[model samples]
Target chain A: MHFGPHLLLAALEGLVTSAVLALTALGLSLVFGVMRVVNVAHGEFFMLGAVLAWAITTAIGGHPALGFLAALVIAPLIVGAIALVAERLVLRRLNYNPEATIVATIGMLYIIQQLALTIYGPEARPVEPPFSYRILLPWFGYSGYKLSVIATSALLLIATWLVLTRTKIGLIMRATQYDSETAQAFGIPVGRVYGGVFALGAMLAAIAAALIVPISQAHYLMGQDPLLLSFIVVIIGGLGSLRGTVVAAVLIGLSDGIISMFFSPTLAKIIATLLVAMVLVFRPQGLFGTASR
Target chain B: MTDKNGFFDLSKSTLTRRTALKGLAAGAGLGLAPGFVRYSQAQSSAPIKIGFQSHRTGIGAAYGRWYEKTTAAAVKAINAAGGINGRQVEVIIEDDGTDPGRGAEVVGKFATQHKTDIVFGTLFSHVVIGSAPAAGENKMPYFVVSEGHHVASTKLNRYVFQPGITDVKSQIESMAPWIAANAGKKVTQIFPDFAFGYDHRDYLPPALKAQGADVIAQIAIPPTESSFTKFFPQIPAETEVIYHVMVGPAVLTFVKELGEFYGPNRPQLFGFIDSLEATDINSPGLEFLDGSHFWEGSPRYAQADDSVAQKAYRTAVGIDDNGAAVGDPKDVSTAAHMFGCWETLYVVKKAMEDAGYKGPEDRAKLVEATEALTEFAEGPEHPQGPKTFNGKIHQCFGIQNISKVEGGKLKVVHKTKIEDGLYEAEGDYTTQAL
Candidate 1:
């Protein structure tokens, strides 16, 4: 419990938090960047993924790794399909209008939350980690599963970056984002691109939820904190910059962990919020966002 | 009928066009003609509506669900036993969302719109405090199952009463003797940074000190925190016991992280069952708590020497021997606190019967009758344990249970006498005007 080891543990905890937050915030950034829609129900989709993971793991009934692997593959796909249906039924009808879509996603938030409550009930159920290995250091012990989460998230972020920047789908999506009318005139099928981006964004959130569910239990109200923190990351990272989102998540997560160690938890939150406010006032465009054209 | 002043012949017994139409509409709105007749005859037999302010959609939803089930079971039993004063009991539920602002609004609605006889069943201390003012303003007798010291401190108005569960001050005071003697002498406290946690933070030290045990460190974690490893370092090395009382959804994470941090080499752990009321003790990450102890208001798992009354209460509440809903093993009950809902309802029935309560007009008399209550025996009506009520503080003093986790089940290890928890009255609720 020396200062050096304590700082190392706090930093490691911060890294785990940053891993989940980056993936969740990246989803929001992707949707905002391409479709120009603020999806408020994004957090509920994350919650759905966690809940589905519990159901799947409980039903599979085998080695814990087998159930976790199955959940990792299936939960995100189901959540993506749910997001696709929602976009078609609600967001598309609103013509992706910023204000109208915001309202629609908020409605979706409550609908999904209530549905989960009705089906899963109101308990915070835990999912067994695929592996339970404690790494004992001279200073303290740590969860090996937590370290796996950081690595998995890093790989997923890199894969997502490659898909967005180095593929044909990425090119079309960027073209649509730059000018939807121009892309449509160029026979790019801009509507399909928008739909795909929305689904892909939600899938990213689901993936984050599936990975973090082992560390944190699945509860009906668990989506609330992630939603607030994701919004904070998206805003401070720059409106639609993926790089900015990841950097901001790490910055916020590390500061939160370190600040809480020195000050009372309530005061630490106040300080974090004040820091966000100062950033908004001083740099309106965010750390990585380009100035509005 | 119209009166005969030439403005429809003022006092004459003549039916005017307006009167005839009004009679026709009223008769139709009341449904079949026999329904109207039945309504008139059944006015005195109407059920007594107890408005339930529930946290159905918020952070406290898990506790709220159990409270609802317990309230329903108690009402069913009361109705089956010929009801209270020959009238069946009814519960009108209003969701409070667990927010203090919304809780106040729910109390207002219960008093004005639902027009219930009394408001009952709130658990979270902040919600209870938020709703107390509305109860006082409406002059409604509020029976809260929340074990907060707010009501017992006599800070709130006389309309509020906590007659079922003993307040947090008493519960904390009672634990010191057993903890100091059995658990450890050097205690470090870890609590949430809120009103609920403040009760433990402010009261436990003095009580422990009185028992010849000194509290070396106290760490207050924010309510919103999910991860707890970084805070563990703040606990002093020389500490022998870590007394934690964390609440909310993140409790599992707190416990899991604590397990990983210590890994079978930690201080003696003593925690309030509030942290894991509805949580399964056999959970994977919770293996570290195998030999730890917790304070339970009532034992979760059935005891070997349970009273007949306790057994009957469990059966009526639909919980199996494992303290879970019968047929649903995974759905654990909040056994520590939900018993308050059942006991409080019985208290309400006794008070109303003693006051000859007929309607809301008798609320003042009911309050006076409730204030006169002194003791409750351990029976079907008060199954948790015997209790002595302090009408002056509007609180109750009851026996407390200390249980240890053994073989994946909690076993009751100690039970504090009611006198151990009794304290001097903070202020007298009887001094306040009705």
Candidate 2:
């Protein structure tokens, strides 16, 4: 078919969406690692990244490459700075009450959405994909840009895993995750680690948003799905478990992709939601999640 | 009217460039100077602050962009012609993001902060419903290129006027007679599972029944649908025609999947105005739609009564009457938006001059003048027929009818005039048929 390339490129959107969702889940898992706070507003950070991506990109002549990367840098940094303030002000006060953290983040989500509407207004504007050139595979037409996304996500994931497992900072982060009080008593700067973890989680989400901006047009409220998808992934993979996140993300992505291809995209959502509900009822801790005490 | 549209009768007298000259001349001398001043002033002093709430990034992005681009083009043309009473129509366009709540907020900001004379756009029914009240409260003329029942509801105020009609039920009204004329058997109905899907669901049953046409089937998915694969197989072998109205990415996805599933025995497709969709007209599934029809406007087919120049514009733009442009396969939105923007801006220019509004300011007065506006030249809806928004609900009272696709684009096939109050709806299924 003459439109074979177009058709393939469209299908590639599913894969890229998966890769981006994996990144978002990575943020969720990392945040779970330290504070044990289910940051409901993690997707808000992703949304901020998308918003900033558009802002920075449009400011820079809509050159998506520089724009997205700039958002990548700026989004995480801004979110991290905000996280720092929230920690000093809000989360620090709620240390004894985990539910408070959840409530706070949920509140923050609405605030952020409203703020975005104020800043950008509600409209879907296509962000120029940082690259030009559709990669037309011989068998069908797959987008080169989507392939680029898959590659970039692969690199980021590897880099993240190495940082968490091989470095001294990684040990500190893991120790802090197990019990913040225990790690602090051992003379580790648990507070600083917490800050860093927050920054790191936010940074991953920001990166995901930057990558997603090109394919999914930037809008004020695009973060909702990624956030939901990430929550599902992190739990299914096991909380604070990087390997679990990776596997779950890919699995969910593939399921979503194939379902969308064969059935309806809406029904695929219903199926995924149902799957999550069933998993929670039976496994509770998730496929890879450690048994919660 | 079914076989030959009354609105596009080739024998009808058409206003030519020659007749338009006197108006154009008066427009140029008076129109040129103030418009030039206003336009240049907007570019130079104020950035031409025109406010827009377009759905550039959401489900309605397809509809919103056409409103944005066409309005932008019209502003460009009006500014080129002279500037509105002379300041360039500086536009502050915002993407409505396809959410009604967001739309309402954007409308508020445009009215209060941006202080735009008028706000144009938003094709989604929900978005229009959410946004229009703000404009009406502010008494700002909200010109929307949208189709929503609320546009004609009692809630409607003079501040809102649809340059295009609101309710899409009429598209069926215009097209049904033709199906009655052309088809050998009955029609099936299929649509998405949402509000629009339900709206059409309610609209077509009686429309077909009114024509004494048999209803073969009515297929509607749940509100939480992802695809139409499950429903595709149910197209009864006895069903000869299908009346459809699915939109957005779903349009391409649904049709392609259906065509793939249908193979050889696909139903003869009948549609709401959506069949004239610039997005779906020539996609992979278009072969399945070769003989399918939609009741629509004259942007695709030449209105037999239109000026030669209208046909020339269609040919020159590589589009028929549907306001669709060719070149990029997915560029229907751009062309549709550009045309709407052009027409909108031009209409504003005419209204502004007529109202004697001035400069890069006077937003309130400009809006009033726009609300005061009543008439515009009718043009053929490509892939359909001629349409004009000439009635009180701000809908096109006499100008709407049926349209079909010809030459890979939409053209006028039929037309009928229906005033807002004349239709039946106490939830009663009785209405005069075509």
| Candidate that would win on DockQ | 1
Expressed as tens digits, the lDDT of each residue in B247-343 for candidate 1 is 8888998999989988999999999999998898988799999999999998999999999999999999999999999999999999999999999
DockQ (Cα-based) for each candidate: 0.35, 0.04
List each model's interface RMSD.
Answer: 10.6, 17.2
- Candidate 2 i-RMS: 17.2
Candidate 2 lDDT over B272-361, as tens digits, reads 655235454664345556656665543444466656645644554455344545564334543422344445555666666777765325
CA displacement after TM-score superposition, residue A105 of candidate 2 (Å) = 14
TM values, all candidates: 0.95, 0.57
lDDT of 2 by residue, A1-293 (tens): 23443344334555666788888899889888677888888888888877777677767764457766676677667777876676666666566257778888888888887787666655444456666444434533233566788989989999998988999998888888888888989999976777678767877888887876665555666777788899888878888888888888888886776566556567777888887888789987888778866
Those runs of model 2 whose alpha carbons end farther than 4 Å from true positions after fitting are A1-227, A233-237, A240-284, B1-50, B83-88, B183-186, B193-195, B214-226, B233-238, B273-280, B295-330, B334-341, B344-375, B379-391, B398-434
RMSD of 1: 7.6
Q: Which stretches of candidate 1 lie over 4 Å from their true place?
A: B1-38
